[model samples]
Target: MGEILLPLLILCPLAASMIVSVSAGRMGACAIGTVACTGVGISAVISIILSITLLSGPPAGVLQVTLWPWMHIAGFSADIAFMLDRVSMVMILVVTIVGLLIHVYAAGYMRDDPGIARFFGCMTLFVAAMLVLVLASDLLCLFIGWEGVGLCSYLLIGFWYNDPANTAAARKAFYMTRMGDVALLCGLLLLATATGSLRIGAVLAAVTNGQLAPSGVNLAALFILVGALAKSAQIPFQTWLPDAMAGPTPTSALIHAATMVTAGIYLIARLHDLFAMATPIMALTAILGTLTLLMGACTALVQSDLKRILAWSTISQLGYMFLALGCGVWQAALFHLMTHAFFKALLFLTAGAVIMRTGHEQDIFRLGGLRHAMPGLSAAFAVGASALAGLPLVTAGFYSKEMILSGVWHVHFGLTREWTLSGHPLWGIALLGAFLTALYIFRCVFIVFCGKKQGTSATGRTSRLMSIPLGCLCFLSLCGGVIEMPDTLPPLHLFSTLLDPKTPLSHADEPIWLVLAGALAPLAGLGVAWVLWGRATPVMHEIPGQAAIIRLARTGWGMDALYDRVFVQPFRLLTWLTHHDVLAHAITATGRLTQAVSGRIFQARTGFLDILSIWGSRGTGWMAYLLGQLDNGRVRWYAAWIAGGLCAGLAMAVLS
Candidate 1:
């Protein structure tokens, strides 16, 4: 039963998609949508049970169910197999539950679209792909799932294919991710070549046992990091994520915010042991994460579109998770990933509801005072905002974010002697990033939900199904921490027994003052936001340099413009030169040369009959004339004429 269950989890959604596609018009689309979502929900529940049973029982604590031998070589083999363990359990739970909520939300959200059946089918396929990705026992299987999710994202993002911007955004997302996928493939190749296995467990064992060369391991880790960075939309590769908001809001909720984007973090956590071997690469991860964290927060502050703001925030939050992993806190990163899924999805869905009610207007500047008109939406969004802002005891964001910060501090202070490298001072940078995170988060909250209504009121009311998920997510945002937080403070430790079965809690001692400072940074940012934008007569107008600072923060610190000048423009120029100067010149030159040769050959052919007639008159005509003379019975005279004609013809030709 267990062996069959794993395969069932993946196949159910795929089968549902096929059924929906075949019966699109005949069957009621809504009914098909419902059945597909329900199947996914059932699969998700089964995965949870399986994960729990495995986590509770064994030392290896993994269920490996192989369906077939996918590929094999001299020393490498990959199978269509499912692996159930603690990490996969976390991913499967998040993917299914949140995915189900989004599916339900989409039922209403996308009801009016003519392609509802197609949308639902794609969504089901997406869920199945993500499930396969999270549960795959080997790298090859994971890559298949990885590319599958990428394909689904492209489809859903361009669901409204008529919209040029939507299509463009979809292409950008796909191509940019493909860039990362290339790197990931290279990484897989290197891993297989070095360790002679694609199986996750075997690869990890080899890495841990020092069987693989250090250089090969480092390169493989870095190549994998490149893929993770691009897929997750970290620094330099992050531009596509903002444009991806052109997709349907539910897609933004499920793929951009909740599920798909988190795959990068999941990859890092899943391969923590291998990554741990490369200290320099891990340091680079921390640096990149910090840069992206700050970059995202700055960009979010200035975004007028509600979804764009959330998109940037998603990027920022993902940065924090990466930071956690980079700092050697895999568990903490996963914890944050879980919490983020709940809150971010809630925020995006609530934002969707608001947008739908307002006739698709998304500008935060035009929106205000929704607390009175849509109390449920306002409340739900507020809960999500609180969680995002890391407000005290308000939501899961605080606990999860706190865990990540603690991990950063531990890394900064060289607390983990086992993993310490260059001893870079990241505590201050991480602290500043946290501060910016709170400021922008609360800034969005205050502008969109707390202020006076700046624009027209919402025309339609939010549906009950829409509000139900929001309510559940709101409640979870507030209390989800209780299930995830540590038992004590200062030296906070996780209480997730499922995560650490043997220890259940790993405590590290740190300075009390450092811990207090770390805890207070988010609070300080919240205060700053309140003073700057919370009040009627805000500090933005009062302070001398405040306006400029706000403007800079809003403009994403001019990073976009910098990127345009440095990377985008250069690439564009190279493309132009290659196309116009090199390829076009070669093609045009070839055409012109061919035309010139043809013109000369055609001119030479023009007098061909004249030349042929001249030659015939000189030789054959003279001979015929002399023969006619001979036949006339003047034989001696004809012979004399023939010789005279021949001599005359030869003399004439020589003179000419």
Candidate 2:
């Protein structure tokens, strides 16, 4: 069953996609979509079962399914193989389950579109690509899946290609991620060249066992990190994500929140053995994660577009995962990744439901009091938001996020030197970031659901199809916390035994004060938000310098403008020079030279006619004079001359 399960996990969706493409127009869009989604749900169930089985079985045993020999050279070979272990199992489970929910939701969300079949096809392809990425046994196999997902993202983001903005957004996502892809390819080549194996297990063992040099390993790791950063939309590469929101909301939920963006964290965690070689790179990852988290949180605070806000928040949450990885707490990072997938997907889907109801209005100020209209959706959104804000112990977000902060604290103060810059400071940043997270999330929740319906006459309701997923996810968001609780803290964590089997949580004595600080940060942020925006305050719209701040936040801290001035404009100018001045001028000059030569040749042909006419007239005059002399008043001579001239004209006409 294990051998059969891995390939079926990938093949099922791909086969369904092909069927949908062929039958969708005839069977109707909804029917085709339903079948595809049903297939995905089945795959999800299989993936979950596989994960449970793997967790219950031997930790070292890997289930490998080899499709074919991908490549063979003199000294190297690569295979299209899928390896199912603990890490890959976890990721596959997340992708398929969340993916199934999104697909079902999209059935209703995109019911009216003429291109619904295309949408389902693209989604199926995306699921297959992500599954391949997670299950890939070698770096080459993984890259194929990586590029595949990127392609799917571009297609989906530009689904409404008639909209120029959507097209540009898709292009931006493609190009930016391509840059990272190149880096990843280079890193993979380096690994293959150095270690002669792209298999994750082999490469990790080689690095961990000190068979590879620390410097070379770190460089390769850095190159890989570049790809992870771009694909995951970390700092400098993050601007693409906001633009990516130009895609349909369903695409947004799947790509940004659920699967694709989380790939970076997965990559780092999967290759933890390689990363452990270079402490500096790990520290950099932590710092970058911290900075990204702060930037995303601060940016989210100002975004008015509901999707854009979620986009930034996704980037922020991903940063926390990286932070956890940076601190050498792989389990914590993976835990957060799981919890985040649940809540974030829930938030985006619920937002989509609200948008669909309100005729696609995403502005929070223009939306309000949805709680009464969409009770289930409202409840789901609230649950998700609570988790997002890491509110208490009710949601998955609290446990996972708490675990991350706890890991940072333990590694920073407990395990490392106190005065080290990379140590305690990361913990401090994590705590501060948690506070900001609470503030913006509560603000979003309050504005969208708590107040009077903004510019509305009545409440808008969601459909049963939409409400079901939200309800399910809301339950998951609440109960998912039980999967990752520290043994010292709780008894219900099913996942506690699955990770770090060699070292139990009981051995890592984490300080209570650190836990208190992490917990308190979100509480503080929530309190501030309630005080500022929860009620019908007198200064609600009369905020001091609110206009400037709101404008700044809405503009994403002027990062886009800065990028335009610093990068886009310069690039445009260079392109203009290269295309217009260099290539264009060369082509234009060559064209003119050809035209001039052709014109001279044409002039030579016309000159031949003038010369011929001059000669012909002179010759004709001589002949006519001689004929007159010979004629001697005879009409025969004149007749002869006329006949000769007529014969000459006939010959000339034939020649011409």
Candidate 3:
């Protein structure tokens, strides 16, 4: 019963996508939307039922359900299998439930568009691919879903291909993620070579028991880390995400915000053994996460475009998850991932409604006083923003974020003992980032949703489909953290024990001072926002900053420009040189000579005989051999051979 029911979590949505895709032209918009929603809805309902059953029963450390043999090549073999336990159960519930809401929301969001069927099909495919990604028990099977997600993202992001810019942005996203995929594939290959199996369990078991070489383990972990960083849109790979707003709103909510972008964090959490073996890489991950969070927060502070600001915020928030992973608090990272998904999805969808109302204007400074006109939406935004800002115990983000801050404050393992009293520099960065996160988000919230109406918006309000999901997400965002309260103030750390039982969390019972600091960070930033932008008349022009620094933050600290200078320009120059180089000139000269010879040969009458002989016989090689034999000096012999050959050829033709 479990075997049949489990893989269906992936198959059901995939089947729905195929159905809608094949019958696209014939199906009405309503039919298409129904099929898409039913596909994902069924999967979500099944997952919830399964999760409830599993939690109520005895705790199974992990359930490896093998479906069929998938790959057998050389010395490598892997099954189309799924590992079902509490850890993955958490991810599946988030993906399917939130994914379903976005699908329903998209139907109303894209109702009037003629390409509604295409949108539904692609969105359903995205959900299916994500399901496969999470449920996969082996690295090889996981990669299939990984690449599937990148493919679906490309198709959906470029759904509006009429605009060249949208297509360009889509291409950017696909290629950027692909770079990471390549690194991940290499890591998988190395793991296969080292462990002699692509099964996740075998590889992890090998790593856990010290069966694999230390050097191989380090290299494999590093390569996989590169892939995760890129997929999760951390730091350098992050530029593509902000530009990805060129897609429709639901696309943003599903692929970027709620699901695909979190794949990296999932990868790290799933393979904690491999990462634990390579402490150096995990240590570096700490630095990367700290710098990335600050980078995102600072960048988000200056952006006026609502989506771009959210995009940067996502980059920063993902940094927090990594920071927790680096601290070896796997459950904390996973907890933050779930809470972030709920609020972030709500934020993006609510922003979508606002975009729809204001004629798709995303610049927060350009719009004002939406609180009175759209009270429900304004209320939703307030909920999302408060959760995002980590407003104490009332919001899910507050609890999850405090756990991470506790991890950082203790200087867990990676930092030197000298800094134990004050904590690591990374902790300071994360703390500063926490403040900036609150400041930037609330700043935008006050500027856009408050004061007098700046410009007129469309008459239609957010639909029931959109509002219902937003309301549900708002509730989740506020209360979701109750499942994993801090050890000092919890019923029990049930979420942690089930999600990551092996490694006890060091920061579970955080110091009172640290908890107080985490509680105050958001308040401090909010106070700053309230003073700077809340009470003051909203200005469309600029906040307090010189031209240079504001421009730097707005341009993502010029990371793209720097890349263009350091990588892009040099690459283009090399391509140009190679195209017109000496080797190319020589090839061109040889091509001219061959063309001349062919022209002269075809002009002669005897050339026709040579062409016929070449065609009728084997090829140019056989014709050359025949020409070589023409030097035989007996005229009668040659004439007799030719006459007999012609007679035989004529007889063959007549028979045919």
Best by TM-score: 3
The sequence of per-residue lDDT tens digits that candidate 2 reaches over residues 239-271 is: 899899888888998988889999888988889
Q: On residues 504-550, what C-alpha lDDT tens digit does candidate 1 reach at each position?
A: 53545645575566568888998998898788866662223358876
lDDT winner: 3
Clashes (backbone N, CA, C under 3 Å), per candidate, total: 0, 0, 0
Worst 10 residues of 1 by lDDT: 486-495
List RMSD in Å for every model shown: 8.2, 12.5, 14.6
Better of 2 and 3 by lDDT: 3
Q: Roughly what TM-score does model 3 have, to 2 decimal places?
A: 0.86
Estimate TM-scores for all models. 0.85, 0.86, 0.86
**Residue 578 lDDT, candidate 2, scale 0-100:** 86
Local accuracy of candidate 3 as per-residue lDDT tens digits, 1-656 = 56667888888899999998899789888888889999999999989887877777676556568889987888889888897788789999999999998888988899888888888888888888998889899899999889999999898889999999999889888888988999999999999988889887788999999987878888998899899999999977888899888989999988998899999999999998888888777777777888899999998998889999899999999999988887667778898999999999999999999999888888886788888888898899889999999999899999889878877777555334453223367777888898999999998888888755686654587889778889899999998888766656754566777765665464545667777788899999999888777875533335656789887888888888987898778988989888779678889999999999988877885878888887877777787888888867989988998999999999999999
State in Å the error of residue 637, model 2: 85
Structure candidate 2, residue pairs in collision: none
* C-alpha lDDT of candidate 1 relative to the true structure: 0.82
